[model samples]
Target: MNKYIIYLIALVSGVLGVFAFSPFDYWGLAYVSLLGLIFVAKTSKKSTALFASFLWSMGFFCFGVNWLNVSIYQFGGASLGVSYFLVGLLSAYLALYPVLFTYLVQRFNVQSAVIFSVIWTFTEFLRGWLFTGFPWLQLGYTQIDSPFSGIAPIFGVTGLTFFTVWASASIFNGVAALFNGKNPKIALFNAVLLAGVGGLSAYAQRIDFVKPVQNEPLRVTLLQGNIEQNLKWDPDYLYSTLEIYQKLIAQHLGKSDLIILPESALPTLENALVPFFERLDRAGQAADTEIVIGTVYQDVHSDKLFNSMVSVGNPNFPYRLETLNRYSKRHLVPFGEYVPLETLLRPLNSVFNLPMSAFQSGAVAQPPFMAKARVFAPAICYEIIFGELVRQNLKNDTDYLLTISNDAWFGNSIGPWQHLQMARMRALELGKPLIRATNTGISVFIGAKGEILAQAPQFVETALTYDIAPMKGKTPYSVLGDMPLYGLSLLFLMLRGMMAFMRRRMNLSQKP
Candidate 1:
């Protein structure tokens, strides 16, 4: 085969893998893509394999997250040329993970499937938190609807990534052996291994890790304002946006137990919207309902701002700004919520000048907001992607998980759908019902089993009203988190290294 042709195949395979995710959801494509990657890595030289992996991941990130350019060029006020350049730069940087993974595997001559799976999973885990973590388009996310999804509650997304990669490697080895006609037994074993794992996963889907709490389902109303991202912060549009949400709340106030609003539903600062909040609090009191709304809150002492969700008209607490319960977003988007290396990048473009771009992160260990005697773990915007962050917020009595996002920044793209999928995974991992409200669309109520109960259409001005049964008990993934899977990966890597060393010693003795 031609060398350049191999690289092109690798790149195309990565591009094809995107279809396995949201909007497309061709799950089997992930396996085919991985097989292509394995072929390139095994056939090429070390340097060629490194380059091929880089090209492959570049294609993956470039296609998967191209929606980022929408926010940069259209909303962030960056020039078209700069937006494209930045997008390319970001994709290239993310591509390094695969490049390094392939390079290391070849450099150390690590041929064991266990070692490869461990390294791939560890690389993914590192990418998630290193440099404030981009963790988007993780391999495990593609399996959300696959049969492998059954193991999500036991192992979390990282575990799923490991299994997916391991299975792909097994399939590749089996297929290659069958074609060569030199290792029939090995090929048969691989086939049986793959089938057995799939069978177990199918059976695992029937297991209920968490039981429904015997409490009455919460009657919830999610408000989608469909506010334009460009006009969201304009002073002129503030009152109109407020009025739209106010009317929505008024309509649902008496009818629902809880009324939820999208992130940044109020464009103005909390202090500026005191009167508006006061009125809503009065309405909530009158209707005997709780209102959870997203807005920007600033600290008077430090003058620092935070992206926050505040609950008003809770019969248990006063509507006072200081006394009202709130959950401030902790995981902020780099260069979106706050710019990194502000001194260096702030001068480059109007992108860093976005409204609330300098917002501060909330405390990591903040408690969940209480509503109607039930605790709700709250995540704002980009925060939902971090499963451990959500898991840490959950407690023994936590009932529901809530995430409010302003996905209008993504415009008409797969970004919002992917974001919603991640939220569903979080629900599945924690065995908790999730209430997701978005600025423009994709607001949904996901069940404990990660099933979508009800959702609103995109770019629509509407509200979704539904009753969600809060679940009790914890999934094993929730209890152990990702530590057990990490440990398993480490165990496999160590075992492979020990076996390799023993084999080396035996060969040396035989030669002597």
Candidate 2:
């Protein structure tokens, strides 16, 4: 085969892998994608393998996260040239991870499927946390709707990545062996192993990791205001935005036990909305309902602003201040929420000059939102992507998980759908119902098992009403977190290293 043709095949495989994720959801394609990687690396020289993998990763990130350019050019007011340049730079940087993976495998001559899977998973873990982490388009996220998703509660997303890569490599090696008319027994063993893994995944779907807590089912209404990012924070549109949400809340006042508005649903600060909150308090007192509104809150003394979720008129407090039951966003997006080096980057473009871009992060150990005699953990927008961070906020008595986002920044891109899918994975991992409210749609209620119970249309002004039974007990992933999976990956690496050492010693001794 032509060398450039092979590289093009690798790139195409990576592009096809994107279909395995949201919107397309052709998950089985992921196997074929990884199989291409395995075949290229096995057949090519070290340098060729490294370059091929880099090409594949470049294609993967370029296509998958192309939505980044949409936000940068459309909303951030960057020039088309600057937006594409930045996107290209990001794709190149992300591609380096695969470069490193391929380089290590070639250098070490790692042929074991177990070792390859471990290295792949460990690299993913590193990518998630390094440089404040971009962690988008993780391989495991593609399996959210696949049979493999059943193991998410046990091993989390990283574990699913490990198993997925392992299965892909195993099948590729086995097929190659059979085609060469050698090692028929090895091919048969690989077939059986693949079957066993699939069988286990299917079986895992039936296992109940958590039970429903015996409480009155909560009737929740998630509101999508469908606000445009350009006008969301414009001072002239503030009154209309507030009125839109206020009227939406009023319509669901008596019908819902809890009403949720998307993040920054109100364009103004909490201090500016005192009268509106007071009016809502009176209405809530009459309706016996609780409202969770997403708005900015300013600290009077510190002069700091927070992207916050404030509960108004909880049955417990009829006329308390809106700040009484507020949960501020702890994890703020690096460039979006607050520029890294504001002193240097502030003057670069309108993106850094975004309104309210310098908001303060809430405390990591802050209290959950209280409503309807239950505890609700709240994550604002980008914070939902961090599994461990979200797990840290979960409590023994926490009844529901709530995430609010204004994805209008992503426009009609795949970014919103991918974000929604991650939220569902979190719900499945925790064995709790998740209420997700978003601006410009994909607002949904996800069940404990990661099923989308109800969803609103994208880019639409609508509200979804659903009854969610709060769950008690914790899933394995919730209890142990990612520690067990990380430990297993480390163990595999150690074992492979020892085996490699033994093989070297045997070869040296046999040289005599």
Name the best candidate (by lDDT).
Answer: 1
- Point out where model 1 deviates above 4 Å: none
Show where candidate 2 strays beyond 4 Å: 318-324
Instruction: Give the alpha carbon lDDT tens digit for every residue of 378-414 in model 1.
Output: 9898989999999988888899999999999999999
- lDDT tens readout by residue for model 2, 104-186: 77877777787789878867878888978878887888898998888899888877888889998888778888898987997
- Error of model 1, residue 463, in angstroms: 0.6
Clashes of 2: 0
Show how many residue pairs clash in every candidate, following the order shown. 0, 0
TM-score against native, each model: 0.98, 0.97
lDDT of each: 0.87, 0.85
Q: Could you tell me the TM-score of candidate 2? A: 0.97
